[model samples]
Target chain A: MWDYSETVKEHFYNPKNAGAVAEANAVGDVGSISCGDALRLTLKVDADTEIILDAGFQTFGCGSAIASSSALTEMVKGKTLDQALEISNQDIADFLDGLPPEKMHCSVMGREALQAAVADYRGEEWVDDHEEGALVCKCFAIDDVMIRDTIKANNLTTVEEVTNYTKAGGGCSSCHEGIENILAEELAARGETFTPGAVGKKEGFVNLAEKEAAPAKLTGVKRILKIQEILEGLRPALQADGGDVELMDVEGKNIYVKLVGACSGCQMAAMTLGGVQQKMIEELGEFVKVIPESERPVEIAGA
Target chain B: MADIYLDNNATTMCDPEVVAAVQPYFSEQFGNPSSLHNFGNKVGFAIKKARKSIQTILGAEHDSEIIFTSCGSESDSTAILSALKAQPERKEIITTVVEHPAVLTLCEFLETEGYTVHYLKVDNKGRLDLDEYASLLTDQVAVVSVMWANNETGTIFPVEQMAEMADAKGVMFHTDAVQAVGKIPMNLADSKIHMLSLSGHKLHAPKGVGVLYLRRGVRFRPLLRGGHQERGRRAGTENTIGIVGLGKACDLALEHMEYENTEVAKLRDRLQEGILAAVPHSFVTGDPDNRLPNTCNIAFEYIEGEAILLLMNKQGIAASSGSACTSGSLEPSHVMKAMGIPYTAAHGTVRFSLSRYTTPEEIERVIEAVPPIVEQLRKLSPYWGDGGPIENPEEAFAPVYA
Candidate 1:
């Protein structure tokens, strides 16, 4: 068990304010069933004078989610719309005696609800209200407009932060550079001159840690191979669960497979890895090794 | 609220009698074991008494054989790494993939540094393939470290058989009996095993104390170098209180071994039976028979182990899981992986390690509370929804929605 303090557990169990305010000025709902953790956060903001009112939330997550919701509710209970808007994911995480590093996303759920509530209070809607599109990151329900706006609003600093905040880059990090392109485009559209070298220059010099992190880069590097033949045999097992694995890379001996759609998060990835992937890969020869990245990658635009 | 705790494998509440034994070490006999005075001699005498207490319980023939260390992991590290160091010309080490990380990681590091590591694989039920292990044996292999019982699966490998294999090959053999020592009856003289590691915390003893049994005349090197302590083997000021507690705990374990082997094993089986019956898509992780009397690992599908463990914590039932969700690593257990446990089961695998202190009442509450919590999570599972096919009838057997 992660050491959740007594105070935090008490708050999670007996949250100070939990129910939604009746017909509240701004109702912010941040999680969804599709998402592992979601927050249905409603804010009661003053309309006539545009002042402070009330806040409450319902969260579906581990202690971090409930605690973050309780902490955020306690934070913006009487604060003005703008002040409540300023409460960030980091602030809420810090307030709850801290969350584990990976669950930092729970605090982000709280922050998203706060943002959505603030936007609703301001009588605003998502920029691309209705649009035609393929699911960019089906796992997170993130789309092109949200990804663009996240970059535009947050000045998205890195590809990782995008995944961290928006849950978009997590799925197929394939869209990483594409999102970066959109980020640069949006910056340019705002007339902020886009300097191509700015990306590397700001983090300009190489640090020792970066040098030490070289092994993963070396290991992750893919070598060219006959992808068609590998997929041909691997498709049978993939089709069993209404899912499929595509060979992303073939680096010498190691084969990297991407789990698509439902299969991405399926509990049987080991069966996928060993029962299916390994069996087929090993059938080819003892030399062929499989490195399956089975975790789902949702579209997460880091701000 | 009265919360349930089953995570005994992590660490356990110190035994009351052992606590009473250790209390004096911290206060009345607080002098350093290394101090060169009468007061220190009293502390030294206390340690000597504690060692003798353990020696009596272990049925060890000699006092010098019991080398005290900080913890079971430390003893495992010292024994395995020391064997490698002593037999420098031997560049290969053979061990099961299921050995604890203390020995496993050291072997991995050794493998990276030009030493060959042959990880003998286990079957789906977590049994080591002795033939496979035997095939890997070579004259140049320096050491072999196989755990007496796996911490996660509770599967009992044929340690005596494997140890004899190592002995026949003239390779130094070690067993991390951290979880097994007090739970199982271990006769050091009977087995041909060269080295054995035991943990105190597993048997309700204090945490920072453990034992390393190096059979007489085994080639070894000291992992610690300092002022003479542990007969110049592991050098440091002894954790007097912990050792005393461990010594007392060992005595207790020795006294209760038969009772535990029977009654406690019944309680563990009761838990396993209730969970498998009440919870759908759930099954035990290790071999049903031929295992430790105290451990039961059950996996509840479509749920995370940490979440299950957390809910169990809320109800005051403590158990652990090999679920990757428990730690920063999103990937589930490598032990489960080596055993070919499917990821769905791996994500949901929770280990309930029993002790002499574990009661039938605790098992009853776990049986009542665990099924509902699992049902709550499964109800929300997308696969159980209307759009999904009910491949198994249990998926359709809904626990009347609240």
Candidate 2:
């Protein structure tokens, strides 16, 4: 449900190097104090040849952490120190098919620890966190300028949308609410009106994301006969109630709608959601289960 | 989606029989249980019958001991508050470390209000350290309330012996039997415990109703003050539907009481064994013995519990996890932590609790679904390879061929 990249699902369902090694040459441990992922890796190296015969990992973390650990153990074994250094975080992520940009950091940790162990083996003071730092991923990495640009380009729609599109503050979350403040600052600089919801969970995160991502395209709908037409026609009515309805993609009978502004906090939102919107949507010939778009699947962070 | 109900420890399905019992109150026979007229008398008879039925279950000495409450939380608050009220001058109470939040947080609140509360520690197996508990008990202690069994781990505490200790000193004893009632054999008359709380929802009864057992002559004050209901011991309009459902649930439980321990235990043990055998790095948490007949807490080392629950949910298997969200702190289960379970295993704790409804087929589905998920998560771990990414999955899979 967490918009996991199919790659994460694959790795999670088939993690490698699960058990403890019979004997390990070097064991490395690393984790973040903020995120609750703590990892302990074991290595079994042939003493005479100084080549890793077998390696295993034991992690106390999430899917990405476990898969990254398992994937890395298989990547580096039997390789010489120099060859192992060539294996980057990107390479580790790619090996597991690919990690969600938010979860790329888990793979990065695997890369760093792997490189660090190799460094320790070669008697070099190298840390792996720095290996993939140069790669400027506009979507995931923390390069302030890229973030500012992404937020600016996405428009002053909603803070929640910026998170979905750009993966800002997605990794090692503790910065998401802070990311919203940063968005507000950027909007203020541009002389754009940016007011966050006064209270309650975001009126609707899924629609907020859909709205931001499909800004230009949402207006120019090719098919006018579907539920989208009802959403477009009913927008003015919802606005009159001090609320706005945003369409979250309709896949058959399940129509997701977000209640913005005063409508979100209104006790009548549930009835309006089911009775008004659901009935109208059904009249448009769809079995309407008007789920609150905010409550729908918008990956906040790892559970 | 298949929304199978399996988290009995969390809450159970409202039994159809219990639902039928309360249907009359919701529809035709609706009336207050305390009116002077025939309608009131009829409802009052229903309330009394429900109380007597629960009394028989607890083997209570007095039917007056069973007081219907709003829920388990209210029952807990009433018990602790009564202990404090009895000895307003004294400011000490004692409880175990793993008591449910209903009891634990109330003790915390009491401690904040100048009440000296002693928390009895538990060992690695979640067994109560009675010596540590005894050391804290003194004449100044007004009461001692420990849970009969923990909610997350299903580790049964030695409350009966602890009750005897409290009784010797004229101190009151209470137990939050929220998770233990149907699973364990609890008889208040035979035991030294004076007060016990059981939420209807924990059994097959509906929510909004609970019972607090007060031994005869135990001094206490009403928590809710209003018109006289519950003999003025608790003063609120009786939750008529809830009372009826709870009464019926107690009757069904009594009928099925003989096989509850053995049948539920067998299913739980099957689940525990199958999970351990299937998953490579996973092992069961809590003591193998001295555990609940229907609960197994297993730590699938290196993964988050919430993620596992989400995954299990996708597979249509309902279960519980002792994750960071459950604890107010970002840390894992406090019970698991008190047992000295390392953070590695602690984060991955999942509780597969069974009931009379559980079957071996469900256990088989769990075993089939879990291992591959664990294996998959491990493949993505940063700890897997120290030097770089893993390349040779075939060689890794070679052992399977062998």
Candidate 3:
């Protein structure tokens, strides 16, 4: 559970200006359901002064998110559009006596919504550099620009903290390597290379996330064709060992294989299974699991 | 303030009787179970008696099979790594995609160590594909560890059947029954489960105490190497008080098992049904018939789970979620993701787990409080439409010139 500050809890419990502004000139909605947090900021601005006469927010997120939205509305109520644009996510966190690092992304949502709302007030588009940035975290629709900005703002060196701050690399973590690369690039620009310390090296997250995130929807003839190609590559070595491996059937994404001759009873057969599966994943975009026929796990005598 | 707690799956409050049972150990009975004196002997005896109670509940062949550990994660690690060490020749593991981090994270680490892990997928209702499971069990597989019941959805796995299949194939079978031991019945004596892990806190005992039930005569390797404690199966002096509390908790759970499955289950169904009837665009997750009696995981579209939970908290209602925002991870639950739950619904999924202590009044309070909360959050949601959630959350990436 999050160690939410008292101020955050207070604002979340009794959020002020939580409803949408009716007949509002400016409306800004940012984030997506996929990200698990979204905010819509509605501002009733004085047209001549460009002052935010009133601010309202409707947020779909956690406590930190509601608190951030509530705090953001309070922060921008009396500020001009230009002044409102200067309110960073950090300012929202500060207002709430600081949010848990993991909930910083909630504050980030508030800032983005505010920016979008301001852009709407000016009758202009959110012209964020995110438009040009590559999509690094597809699970959350987070772009490279979002990652870079959060990293620079928080002086973040670890992927975990980056996820906390920006929600990039938070889902399906297949983008961990991508996040690591961006973190390094951002740090390098600041003349600060991440000192790969205990925490950084301990998780070794890149391989696992990348591997687990393998495409999960390959099927039909395409799946069979890919599995067959992988089997062909693995055939020669098995043949040399007086053993042969063949793809027998494809059920959904599961590839049924039969090991003929020596390979059927070989001690290193598990290694072969791993090899076949790994090769299939590497070549076929990782949607198939190789299930060998005519094999049962080693039986043990019950005590 | 009237508080209602329905997140028992996350952690249960210690039963007063169990707390009383452990109180003495913190003060007067502070002697080490490893000490030679009379005081120590008394503590050791209590620990032994607690083990017997748990053994009785689990229906294990012997009390000796129970080895106390610090937490469920330690027990899981001990069971898995020990199997790998015992069968160094077999380098593969078969598990489910919906396993808790205790198993999944360890399996991920095992992958880096050159171990092959087959994560069996679950269907939309969170039921494991047993045919896929059976196919993955091979001579090269070291062990198959699946959860007795999924914590997020309370969906029970066919552990008894799965264990038998693994046992027939000469593979070790382990089950992380942390969420199942107290919520469901078990008769390990008639089953083929080689090892099982249970957490103290999940069953109304205090945290920091867990159990690893290793079938007697199974190949074993100690995870922690230190003083000859837990018969050398685990190192470090025993957490005597916690063990006693756990034993007492098991006894309490056994005593209340009927109540848990009857009245508490009725309350859960009522809450689930009430919310579903009142709240629009909501549906339950998991196989309804096969789920644990005290658990109901429901997904409310458009509104984020964290936001709903926060509002509930304001109303003094405590619950949990499989939502990405609540997990401190940008991605929603791995369980939901594995089940192929749509993004709009998955983001709003909340888990309400009842306990034997839950009351009908509390259930009524939650039912009354939830509908309005969901309706309120949905009003603010950008995705909520006249019918349900809007499909496209955002437009595809496009350049925005300043």
Error of 3 at B395 (Å): 7.9
The DockQ of each candidate is 0.04, 0.08, 0.23
TM-score of chain B alone in model 2: 0.93
lDDT by residue (B1-402, candidate 3, tens digit) is 579999999899999999899988987888888899988989999999999999998999999999999999999999999999989999999998999999999999799689999999999999988899889989999999999999999999999999999999999999999999988889999999999999999999999999999999888889888888889889898998889999999999999888888888899999999999998889999989998999999999867888788888878999998887776676889998999998778888999999988888888888899998987777666565445555654442111221
Could you give candidate 2's per-residue lDDT for residues B1-402 as a string of tens digits? 344556899999888999888998985777787888887888999999999889988889888999999999899999989988878877899987788889887888777579988888888888877778878778899889898888888888888898999998888999899888866666888877889999999889999999999998889888988978888889989999999899899888887776778887887887778878877667777777887888888887656775677667768888887765333134577788888886656877888777787777777777788887666555444333442324552233111000
* Candidate 3: pairs in clash: A61-B307, A297-B169, A298-B170, A299-B170
> Which candidate number has the best TM-score?
3
> Per-residue error at B260 for model 3, in Å?
1.8
Instruction: Give DockQ: model 1.
Output: 0.04
Higher-scoring candidate on DockQ, 2 or 3: 3
- Output candidate 2 Cα RMSD: 13.4
TM-score list, all predictions? 0.62, 0.63, 0.74
Residues B1-402 of candidate 1: C-alpha lDDT, one tens digit per residue: 455557677787898999998887777888998898987889898889889877776667787889999999899889988988998898988888888889888888787579999998878888877888888888889888889988997788888888888888888899898878778887777788889898888888988889998888898799999969988998998999888898888888889999889998999899999888987778888787878998888877655576677767777777887765465343578898888876546766889988777788888988998988876544433234333324662333221111
- Candidate 1 stretches with Cα past 4 Å from truth are A3-99, A105-303, B34-37, B386-402
lDDT of 1 by residue, A1-303 (tens): 676767567766566666556667776665432223445567776777556577766544455566677888898877777777788877987788776655666687777777777776787863312231223454445666777767778765455445545766554355555556666678778878544444432111122123233332222322233344657676876787688877776655556777786677676554355444335433443234455754324468993
Query: Could you give candidate 2's per-residue lDDT for residues A42-77 as a string of tens digits?
Result: 677666777777877766566567678878888888
lDDT of 3 by residue, A114-136 (tens): 88888887878775432325567
Name the 10 consecutive residues with the lowest summed lDDT in model 3 chain A.
A200-209
